[model samples]
Target: MMEATTQAEVTAYWNARAPAFDGVASHVAQGGVWRDVLAAAFGAGGPRDVVDLGSGTGACALIAASLGHRVRGYDGSEGMLAVARAAAEAAGLSVSFDAAVIDQAAIEPASADIVTLRNVLWTLEQPMVALAQAHAALRPGGMVLVSDGLWSVAPQFRSTYDPALAARLPWHGGLTEADARRMLAETGFGDARSWQHLFASPPYPGDVPMFVLSARKA
Candidate 1:
């Protein structure tokens, strides 16, 4: 099938929408539960470096920074990085921005205490490859945090449909909750545990349905 993901198209899509993404993003999320979920995953603070994948606008990175962890948010979109960098500066936070896909570079193996894949796993044509890379990048005791959901099969993506936004995404994939845990466990993430919370935003079903996941590497 059309390579489920088109990186160039997805990058362009995020680039154009980067500036305004954060403003509208929160409303779409479930009261920002993922932040708290991440906090719980890695604990408050310690010696840890977190790799936030597809970290558009650097929301998660900034949170980790605030909690006193070295944070790096990587994205292929320079525009998105620009926006994230600006926000980090405004918040007086220190988060390094890396400009590349996870698989494109040689990440320091076993250097990270936590690997973050928020909302990114479902958008890749090579989720397993990316997961393996993330696994390799984590320290022995490190962890991988992933959060996305089952894609739209019912009525299949109707509302929340913004032409400007929709035009930006090249393609999308939906991951089952079971597989989220399976990938992490098989990739050598010791004691992989799945976290699922129904985020109902009082009304919009599509915008609120999401899950945040984390798996620890042995």
Candidate 2:
């Protein structure tokens, strides 16, 4: 298990990356396949109450809102929240953003139709705890989308050329598709399944596939 203080570093790292993270949102918006995939998992209907955890720069939350879902984006980093808020305003989308950690977000039980956690698990110090919170925040039939990939499992490109680079990198082990499914099942989720799509921005290697682990509250 990771120590609690590690969260501080995580928050700081994200704060620094907050501005650049909007490129991810832009990429997702511009990409047809990814948008279609998200719509299928999240439903095409509008006005669903969606809660997005670790919502950096409103990537998922803002997009959901744009599609007419009632979205709330919660993040621990104030820097990210600020950017998200501005983006929401600029887009004329009514996305509510709050500064809160995933595990401890002040969401009510059975209050949301959907929950999203994109690329957040690997950085978490208490992933199980955060998943439990997600389970609690959802309505009985609500679905949660866990979007992640084998980022750390990919070759250390920088380290391949420099011997000392590997030690400096933050190597939090990533989950396999099976690992993601098992986790949702173990955390009281039902009907867990998987979907995948490639994102265009940040330019991950073609071999490193991005996956979406969709599960419903039982």
Tell me the TM-score of model 2: 0.84
Full-model lDDT for every candidate: 0.70, 0.75
TM-score of each: 0.81, 0.84
Worst 10 residues of 2 by lDDT: 157-166
For residues 1-218, what per-residue lDDT tens digits would candidate 2 score against the true structure?
33545666678777987787756443444545556667878865658999999998777887788778999889989998999899889989998898988877889889999999987876676678778988999999899999776765565521121223223323245567787787888899997776674343433443555578789997
At residue 97, give the lDDT of candidate 1: 92
Candidate number with greatest lDDT: 2
lDDT for position 207 in model 2 = 55
Model 2, which residues run further than 4 Å from truth? 1-3, 23-32, 155-171, 197-203
Name the lDDT value of residue 147 in candidate 2. Answer: 79
